[model samples]
Target: MENNTIIKTSLDPRSTFDKYEKRPLINAVTTESYEPKPQAHNSKIIIESIIHGFDNFRKFSRFYAFMGLVAGSFFSSLLAVDNLSQLFPTFFNGYLQYIVPHFFMHLYIVGLNQLADLEIDKINKPYLPLAYGEFSFTNGVITVASFLFLSFGSAWMIGSKPSLWSLLVTFVLMTAYSINLPFLRWKKSTTLTVMAHAIGMTTSFNIAAFMHMKTFVLKKATTYPRSLFLATVVMAIFFAVVAMAKVFWFCVSLLEIAYGAAILIGASSPFLWSKLFTT
Candidate 1:
């Protein structure tokens, strides 16, 4: 009887092993079926995405470049208004008025450029935040649009005529150059690109002069000097010529021209000379 029982156990051993193995498989299937699927999109996820998008935008834009541009514009305007000695005393006070508006204007331009160039950037510069998916398209558009509105509104509120005109012109020209609107994307052509940059730089130079006159000279002086206008035109012509060349050496040459022209204009103009020498 014991021998017969052992024989039966040996023959049925495979059946017992199969039953135990199948139990975990059935349990796994049941557990998976009951598990919740992740939500594809949600408010929390969206908020986090947008926050990341802003961070990416800031990094891609190169914050220091914007600061340098604003500083150049501010100091150029100050020099137009007063001599070096006189500028030191009032520099901080005047900088405060122009900084916010200039910052927003620069942000608007850079944001628009990045927004429009997303596709090109993927091929040419994949590391860009927008190209790399670090920043969402919708958030980028909203951020740029906000900067545009803030720039214009702040310039208007400050009542700085140069700041207002500069912001408006820069926005319009940069939009035309960067946006893919029909017949407006000037960035496609080398000639148009150079032309756009030249015009933008020239207008920015004028803006600095206008800001200076408005801030320091307009109230005290009866007539705006002709020499200053001539100097601005000369600077613009030189800038446009050098910018068209589009070479590194040309850019350096333009800076030298700018300094020489500024000094010549300041020294020659009776009004500016009187201001510089008299006080």
Candidate 2:
């Protein structure tokens, strides 16, 4: 059979072997079809997983983000001084007073928020990177320490109050308001929180006034120029109104909306949209 298969060789026009002096050609081997396997790992997939991990962490750590927002708000208040001068041309420039107090306020607010949420965090916010065991305790301590040092150091740099005593007093008040365990629990109580809010507003307005008053004093200007007195009065009233509004809104405003919705629609109505009014 092998001889028969080899003996019937014939030259063909289409065959390259016939044109090339009858050289023998090997047949191709074909056992089965195969495909190459992909690489063990894709670089793009690994990088995407890392990015997704960070995004997930950020979404879970809102309290830390809130602390950052509070710090930004302090800076916002500091810049508001320029705007305030425009509103009241006679405004005194208490630059250090306004800026320092707010820095301290935000630092303490952030620390207190974390402390206040310790319990709630243990329950509801455990997934948060800050509250969870993701960041080391030492890291959190360093972060808080850095914030406090910067805040108080800046206060010392530009404090308007001539006495270190006054600066120390202000720092102590803020720290106590924020940190002391039993003596003054400001964050825990709604009433205390609202009171602190009023105090904060008062401090901000006074800082504006202090800047103006100090400028006038430096210039040896006459006793409290009467022209700006009406504006100050209006501003003080406005501050008071705003404080009350904030307090009211903080307390029963949501409940009020729920009641109003019940009256207009039904008791089962969702309050998601209505909650914006409170905010």
Candidate 3:
């Protein structure tokens, strides 16, 4: 009877409740309030931001652009080949020399456009990295700058006059299109936008033509045929029309116009026809 009385006294309900209640407060004041050191925490944040930045960059569809560039390069090289014996060599060499550099060039242009359009994107594309606060503007700028550097640097290494000139011209035009500081944001006006796209597309096609011609020259063959020139012009016009159509149309209407344009261009260019048919 004495032991039972002692045990009941020690097991007081109020005391147990007090002890249990104090534990959470103690944890709140100590462990719950504790933070990891700033160095590791900040490093983690920086790494995550970089990862998100790249994820945002991939949203630009870089792989598709890269593959398109590669295809263009290969197709142009084939058209430039006057003889079957030189085909494989020209195709391989041009692909090796041109595709990587052009990919970076296109990437630079895309990054600049995104950086300049952050505010507009908030209303139009809130899910974008900058609009959603996933990528800081500073990091975005750094990324664009890095792409610009890689593009021009790779072109210089290639040491091709056409590649260098094309990169330079494209860079200047894209800067005018995206940068507002010098009052050259052509994206504001539909006319200017179409004009810019026209010129940009023309220049891009010319770069492929030039690359093709370079490959032929290296093999001591005649320059690219007049057919190649015609094909390039038709393709340029097709791209320009498609770009304008995108600004004006939506949904099925846009697809109809784009497909119609593609069909017309394809019909006009034996090179494009052959390539498409072969594929």
Q: How many residue pairs clash in each candidate?
A: 0, 5, 0
lDDT of 1 by residue, 31-139 (tens): 7885334564566688898898677766777697675466456545554554565456565556656667767878888878888989988999888787888779998
TM-score for each prediction? 0.62, 0.44, 0.66
Candidate 1 lDDT (Cα, 0 to 1): 0.69
Candidate 2 on 1-279: residue-level lDDT in tens? 877655554434455455565432322233333544455356667788899778754543344534433343334333333345443433323433434544553544455455545567768878655567665556655655666666557656654342133334444544555664777756555555545544444344433334333442233333433223322343334434443565665435544543454344432335655444323
Query: All candidates' lDDT scores?
Result: 0.69, 0.47, 0.69
Worst 10 residues of 2 by lDDT: 23-32
**Residue-by-residue lDDT tens digits, candidate 3, 155-216:** 78777666677677778877888888757998777677767776676565554545535542
Which stretches of candidate 1 lie above 4 Å from their native place? Answer: 1-55, 80-91, 209-218, 222-279
Report the backbone clash tally of model 1.
0
User: What is candidate 1's CA lDDT for residue 151?
Assistant: 85
Question: In model 3, which range of ten residues has the least summed lDDT?
Answer: 212-221
Candidate 1 local Cα displacement, residue 61, angstroms: 2.5
> Is 1 or 2 the stronger prediction by TM-score?
1
Cα RMSDs of all predictions? Answer: 8.9, 12.5, 6.9
What is the alpha-carbon lDDT for the whole of candidate 3?
0.69
